[model samples]
Target chain A: MGLAVILCLITWFVLVNSRKMAPLPVSPTSAMVLVPPPTLTPLPTPTIYVSPTPTQRPGLPPASGGIQVGGYVQITGTSGAGLRLRSGAGLEFDPKFLGMDSEVFEVKEGPVEANGITWWYLVAPYDESRSGWAASNYLQIVTTQP
Target chain B: MDIRPAEITANRANSIVTIQWNDGHRSAYPFGLLRAACPCASCRGGHENMSAEPDAEVFSTVLPESPATRIRSVEAAGSYAIIIEWEDGHHYGIYNWHYLRALCPCEECRSRFGEAV
Candidate 1:
């Protein structure tokens, strides 16, 4: 039993003394050699975003290219109020019409005739319910053909 | 002022929507006010809270001139409602005639339905 106690005391003493021993001091240059050099990688360039300008479509006349169906057209030169959009082509149609100048419309279908005047079918760019025929003379094409 | 509009016109430059009723009552609403008064459940918070009237607070909620409030189109939904499309392609709200009538911000309607009648 005493031999066993001696073995345990020797083991504890060896462990505690070994733990208390200080680590060998290394030079600063040798400690730095253990560290990895930092890599200076280039950062990714940020992309610039450009927002598109709102196109005031369906109003202005084409500069050079001729206007086509599915393009935009504006109401212009209507004395005081604006151009009349009719259920069909002709003055015989209703005269009471909503006229907002500079408003644009999609050319739905047309090149039809009535009462000696040419009319173009239009779908109101703002109000689809206002789709009707407007006399071609009042139309001014705005954007490129769509 | 609880009448259907005989003619509806919007002045984009002025950001105003003028509605002339059959009874000669004219209501000119600011686009910002109307946008806030959108009757969709999303605008009203939830479908359960959706009612026949626009919220009184909507009259004071004026949105800016971004696509969120920019009017792209005004489409009639049959004889009862109007669906307005904004520049951002949001066209869900359907403003019915009765709702619009009740939403009138005129002096007459204000007395009829309080602050934002």
Candidate 2:
């Protein structure tokens, strides 16, 4: 008799909890009103990046042909004859000065093509007036010793 | 080296000017380029702004088609330079051989000078 009473109470408790847990029925119109609207996201804009000429990197050895516009370079491959620095970028321009072998210079301008030769404008660090265009064949990048 | 022009010809039909240098190199300049590269003090902004080289900006500047860009005539100034007269009555630019050669608008010249057109 006591066991039968315990089983009946357990059944009663389950039925009561189930009724509380069950979801309430709703109409389609009510469901739509309760739901939030979908959101729209905009796309990101695209960007264009232009590569710089004579690109440089950190902690790396200078390029063999790194005679850049703002970098330093040394005269080479001219033997002892010296490289002729011209008033302009072409071979036709008058020679402004003669750059000796291994003389260091700062690149001021040029990569101008003339007479089928590549020319660069170099300026002596010691003398600004001693500047002119020299062939790229006789130039080498000057790298700092670490 | 002294550079001089062996010949200069204007093709109004093509709106191009050709200069054959004594060094055997030839430079072809557009009418607008010659006007934009005018070495006159006024065109250059001031007398102090005059330079042996053409301003690097001229290679990319595209002036509108007008009287300023039309070449009325090209005259030799002594033996060293040439004066260009424009249809707009502006004829003060004296382009020397050095300046003209430097102003060459070839792929080689533009690339070496770090400019674009």
Candidate 1 docks at the CAPRI level of: incorrect
- Evaluated at residue A35, the lDDT of candidate 2 is 52
Alpha-carbon RMSD to native, per candidate: 20.4, 25.1
Q: Candidate 1, clashing residue pairs?
A: A58-A72, A58-A73, A60-A141, A60-A142
- Model 2 C-alpha RMSD vs. true structure (Å) is 25.1
Query: What is the TM-score of each predicted model, taking all chains together?
Result: 0.44, 0.43
DockQ of each: 0.02, 0.01
Q: What are the per-residue Cα lDDT tens digits for candidate 1 across A1-146?
A: 99999999999999999999999997766735455789966432212122223455223344543456766555545532456788877778774354433345667887777888777787754346767788877765544352
Against the reference, the lDDT scores of all candidates come to 0.64, 0.68
Cα-based lDDT at residue A123, candidate 2: 75
- Fnat of candidate 1 is 0.00
The positional error of residue A19 in candidate 1, measured at the CA in angstroms, is 99
Q: How good is model 2 by TM-score? A: 0.43
Tens-place lDDT per residue, model 2, A1-146, is 99999999999999999988958876766745555777855422212111221132212225555566876555655544567899888888998767754455667787788999889888765457778899998875543221
What is the model-wide C-alpha lDDT for candidate 1? 0.64
